[model samples]
Target: MGEIKYKRILLKLSGEALMGKQNFGIDGDVVKFIASEVKEAYEMGVQIGIVVGGGNIFRGVSESAKGMDRVSADYMGMLATVINSLALQNALENLGVPTRVQTAIEMRQVAEPFIRRRAIRHLEKGRVVIFGAGTGNPYFTTDTAATLRASEINADVVLKATKVDGVYDADPVKYKDAVKFDAITYLEVLNKGLKVMDSTAISMCMDNEIPIIVFDLFGKGNLKNILLGKKIGTLVEGKHD
Candidate 1:
């Protein structure tokens, strides 16, 4: 295999990825598989930072907000991310990869609070830092948090592990003939209104010139392939003026 292209990357994983085929909650088998992939990448000498979403446990914004306040619902979503982060930390550590969970909300009893310098130090020491609590703010998706952390940590690339193999012209699952692009500019993504990620996240990444590779994490060797700089996913890059 060729040498990995990037030295450090920020991996963005959705909470639903941990659910496997189950209706809800984290699935041990799936978590183990995901952990193994991370281990594989680490063995290839890639520095990894993970940001996990909380949709599996709670989606405060989408749930009935008739009585609940929007901000309160969003806070609940942030807590759900912490739950997923702890679960992932356990899984990664079991595989002998040192890991840390840093939350935006201070819950030192469970995990360390978000500290930029500390996080960078951890990454420098080759420990995977999983960021949780979604920017410690409401009305912001974990996608945005991933972009923010990726920029703060100076990651070379942002690897978004999603359900699909890559970004398509339309929903691949629903539209059988949707065309998948090998690479695209951020401007095209925004112009087309592609749902690879929320606009806020895309804009953040574009502004920072952080390349994002969107690939299917469910597929075997997908994450490892991306780390190896193999042509296995859709890459969105900054637009050239």
Candidate 2:
């Protein structure tokens, strides 16, 4: 295997990535594809932790949350993440990869409660640990949860899997001349108000000294390629332009 920039990493996947062509919920094919990509990385001796969002199932902070209590809507979103986590766990296991699902919200029947040491142990044992439920608190995005976990687990980096290939100056879909950065710094991300991740998430990662790679998850081999140290996405770090 080629040298990997990060020996251990946290992968952040949005719920929409699991939708594939479907309008809502998980798509079996997309899950399988993601599982395959993760498996390839696991085979490279890279320890992996994954955080999945619930936007595809239901976004608590979105327009659908109208008329609902903010806390209530966020709790519902957390549950949706658990559902996605379980689906992903099933897919990875089906492909013969040992995986564990840990949730911030206690649901012992389905998954173990999130414990930092236990999660690290799972990674040491060559198992993929999937974190769900968004920090067990309302008003926090899964992106924050992922960054927090990465810091706790001492992950070398956080791999943000998005539909877009990299962080752009503007929404590529909306602007034909959007500029993509080959690399950027956390301060720039904040100063320029780049939508790489939520401000809270980016700040946490910056404070913890963890770099982030934003890439297109749907692209074939993108995950594995990034793990292998290929420049397949935009790198956001503490320093450099």
- Candidate No. with top TM-score: 2
Q: Model 2 over residues 112-177: C-alpha lDDT tens digits?
A: 999999999999999999999989999899999999999999999999999999999999999989
How close is every model to the real structure, measured as TM-score? Answer: 0.96, 0.98
Deviation (Å) of 217 in candidate 1 = 0.2
| Residues forming the 10-long window of minimal summed lDDT in candidate 1 | 58-67
The lDDT of each candidate is 0.91, 0.95
Error of 2 at 197 (Å): 0.5
**Residue lDDT tens for model 1, 1-241:** 7878889899999999989888789999999999999999888878889999988888877655447898999999899999999999999999999999999999999999999999999988989999999999998999999999999999999999998899999998899999999999998999999998899999999999999999999888988888777888899997432
Sequence-dependent TM-score of model 1: 0.96
Candidate 2: stretches off by over 4 Å: none
